[model samples]
Target: MSVVVAVKPSARKRNAKVGRLVAAEGTRHAFGSRAAAERWAESLSTGDGHVWIAAAHPADDDDVDCYLVSRATNAKLEAAYDKRRRRLRGGEGGKQQSLGGAE
Candidate 1:
């Protein structure tokens, strides 16, 4: 089953309660794997925005498994995203880094 990634605006002081999360325009995507979905969600997360992951609910087959991302995970995702961006922009040796070490 495919996983979905969605982005929405975060709750602010003026809007203490976040509204129902509906996938905004240009902010939803599907991936073949949970890891890929999480990575995409993390890349889109920002101070003013929130990201979520959804999958097929294990308990109820017709239900969706969804949750808001934690702040700590967002931080880690941001770090990885930045590192990737830098590498793409030639900050690294412009050599594609292998996912497996010592390749």
Candidate 2:
């Protein structure tokens, strides 16, 4: 499942004190601090569900992109593998478009 923690200020509340938590599935909640929101997201990220905390909406991004941004280390690992794979595939200087391209 794809989970994202949207930390944005409540527009309905005048001069909101903290950020609000909005899940990708439309689940809404409020958090007193960014740390609290991140913590909540981390809690939700367990077992099969890899939670992603985003301050802004991932409007143009696909699921894989969103999932990767959630974990920096995982993204780095993927990049490294992609470089090696591209080198084996005879990509330009071992740097192709990316791992999952249309071609």
Candidate 3:
């Protein structure tokens, strides 16, 4: 089943969250019209579970071939990040540091 979802103009908050998950997976993403993005997003379902992101097909010739970052992946990444932040902070009131640091 192919479906299209319009892209809602995303702000830094939305984009930033997605970026990290795709990065964790060592993949690339495309940005463009929402309908295209949604189509790609919906294709990630597998027997195990839904994939978090579906990258644009390389065969695309359009000036802008949209890519999709799965909502599932986005949520997991955000949850993991939040947990790491809490762990690093060790307690409330301290500034959370980056996990990507010199590790």
Clash count for each candidate, listed in order shown: 0, 0, 1
Across 1-103, the per-residue lDDT of candidate 1 in tens digits comes to 7755443344221121223233223434457878876765555454445544545446744333443343334567889999889888998776685678655
TM-score winner, 2 or 3: 2
As a whole number from 0 to 100, the lDDT of residue 24 in candidate 1 is 29
| lDDT values, one for every candidate | 0.50, 0.44, 0.44
Over 7-50, each residue of candidate 3 has an lDDT whose tens digit, in order, gives 22231124544444445743444435455555454443333333
| Predicted candidate 2 versus true structure: per-residue lDDT over 36-101, tens digit per residue | 666765665544234444554458553222221233234578888987887979886654455587
* Candidate with best lDDT: 1
Q: With candidate 1 superimposed using the best TM-score fit, by how many Å does residue 12's alpha carbon deviate from the native?
A: 11
Of candidates 3 and 1, the better by lDDT: 1
User: Against the correct fold, how does model 2 do in TM-score?
Assistant: 0.32
Question: Which of 1 and 2 is ahead in lDDT?
Answer: 1
Q: Assess candidate 2 and give its lDDT.
A: 0.44
The alpha-carbon root-mean-square deviation between model 1 and the true structure, to one decimal in Å, is 13.5
- Give the TM-score ranking, best first: 1, 2, 3
Residue pairs whose backbone atoms clash in candidate 2: none
lDDT of model 1, residue 102: 56
